[model samples]
Target: MTDALLVLNAGSSSVKFALYEAAQPGEPPLLAGQIERIGDDPRLATGGTSEPFGQSTDGHAALIGGLLAAIGDLAPGDVRIVGAGHRVVHGGARFDAPVPIGDAVIAELEALTPLAPQHQPHNLAGIAAVAAAYPDIPQVAAFDTAFHRSQSEIAERYALPRGYAEQGMIAYGFHGLSYASIAPRLPALLGPEARRVVVAHLGHGCSMAALLDGRSVATTMGFTALEGLPMGTRSGSIDPGLVLHLLSERGMDVDAVHRLLYDESGLLGLSGISGDMRDLLASDAPEARFAVDYFVDRCARAVGSLAVSLGGLDALVFTGGIGENAGEIREAVGARHAWLAIPPPLAIATDEEGVIAEATARLV
Candidate 1:
């Protein structure tokens, strides 16, 4: 039987997957797809073919089972899924690299859910589902925060107590997998001068990272994914004092504040229509225009700040959904930083699942 690697990125309401014919350096995945709109109108699409998954169960296990069965039916019988890799959103301070997933590892990862409540629980659920479905298969977790482990202590620290920082309450950037997936390509794209680069990963969740010689020197995200650029539904870097005001003066509790910031803010809250950039761009409403403008402004400011961290920027790259597809957004953000003399921002499609597959292949 032919060996293959399955990479899964489980989010709050979707599961994206890719299958790779065992690691061949510089090779691409054999197939990729996602099951989106789960719990509502679940649909599965693979290799550009879309269809209703038709699984009535909303549980993660059922969704994953359906996905695996579908994949099995698509691939030749001689092809075997030998291993799996998961895109775990948070590794806290414990995992600086992709590690094999086991019972002990799962427990440790579970403890990190509070650190990344929106993503970690769903990521863990994917791991559990894969374990139950293919118990003998080796599994590895490629942390979204692992690539930023190269950031300096000062860069990763918060101004709060040093004790809290030491206790894993410091800046642990997300989207590292996306960044890592593109870092190696930068040297070839921009030549050796690309040592100092800033990569803006803009999507439903967004962040910018400063790379010095292809290593993370600093990043915008801190302690959690909500501490960077305003995202689709996340407030990003809001003043902590405002949170206190909501609690003390507005009589909002912790849960209420969480919901407001995590779900009711960002482009959605700003536009009062939808969090999706495409939707906002299509609308003629003033609120939608303002939201789009705000996102561009915030992204431009992040590029400026990251340039300072890198001493200077030789190149700037835009990846992720909005980054790669939204030409107007890219043009606006790039125009704001024109004075920097950095090359026109290069838009590259990020392959996070492929990165996970490669990492898992090494471990297995």
Candidate 2:
């Protein structure tokens, strides 16, 4: 039987999976799929076929079990899953590389939950579920925060007190696996001009990074994913005083404010219609137009700011869902920086699963 690697990217509402030949590094996945909407109206899509799940796949474990069963049915009988790689959102200050899953590593990741409450727990749940099902299989965690570890200390620091900075309240950029996936392909795409590049990873959770010679020198995200550009349902970087005002003057508690910024803000709040960029782009409503305009403005501003960090812009690479699909967004953001005279922004599809699979294969 041919050995295979299973890669899992578990989000709050969905788990995306892919299987690759363990002996093949750059080959395409043997099978890829996602189980979306975990708690509400679940659906499974694989090999271009989409269908509602017949079984009750309520939690991460059940959903993953169902996914495994589906893969077993679809995969060639000669294929054997030898290892699993996971996309973990936060690696905290301790981990800067892919690591083998162990009790100690799991506990350390659990301590980082408060740093990324929306993602860390769900990621851990996926790891737990995989362990329960494939007790002997080796699993490796490839972190989204690990790529930014190459960034300098000054770029990662906050202006807060020394004590706070020492306490891990510094900027720890996210969307790293995406950036990691794109960095290697740059030299081929841009050649010598790839020295100073700013990659905008615009999706439901948006962020940008300044890469100097393929290394992350600066990024938009901070200690949390909420610190970057305004995203689908996230407010991005809002005034800290506004949060305090909600807590005190508006009579809202921390939990209420959290829900507001994390779930009720961004494009959805701005348009009062939908958080999906596809929806906003299609709508003729003034609010929708304004939200789109705002998103583009901030994106351009981020490029300019990141350009400053790179000393100048050699290339601006766009990836992630919105960046890859939205032509109007790319055009508008590019037009704002037309003065730079750089070539058009390059759109590269990210392969976090492939990166995870490679890491898992190497470590295992």
The top-ranked prediction according to lDDT is: 2
TM-score of 1: 0.95
Taking all chains together, each candidate's TM-score versus the true structure is 0.95, 0.95
Identify the runs in model 2 with alpha carbons over 4 angstroms from their true place.
Answer: 37-41, 54-61
lDDT of 1 by residue, 256-333 (tens): 999998888999999999888889999999999999999999999999999999999898899987899999999999
Question: Candidate 2's residue-wise lDDT over 1-364, tens digit each?
Answer: 8899989998755788998999995699998888875665678888789888745547776777777766787786678889999999999887999999999999999999988887898789888878877899999999999999998889999888889988888899998999999999999999975699999999878999999989999999999988979998899999999999999899999999989998889999999998889899999999999999999999999999999998999888899878999988988999988899898988898888899999999998
Model 1 residue pairs with clashes: 171-223
Name the runs in model 1 displaced over 4 angstroms: 23-26, 37-41, 54-62
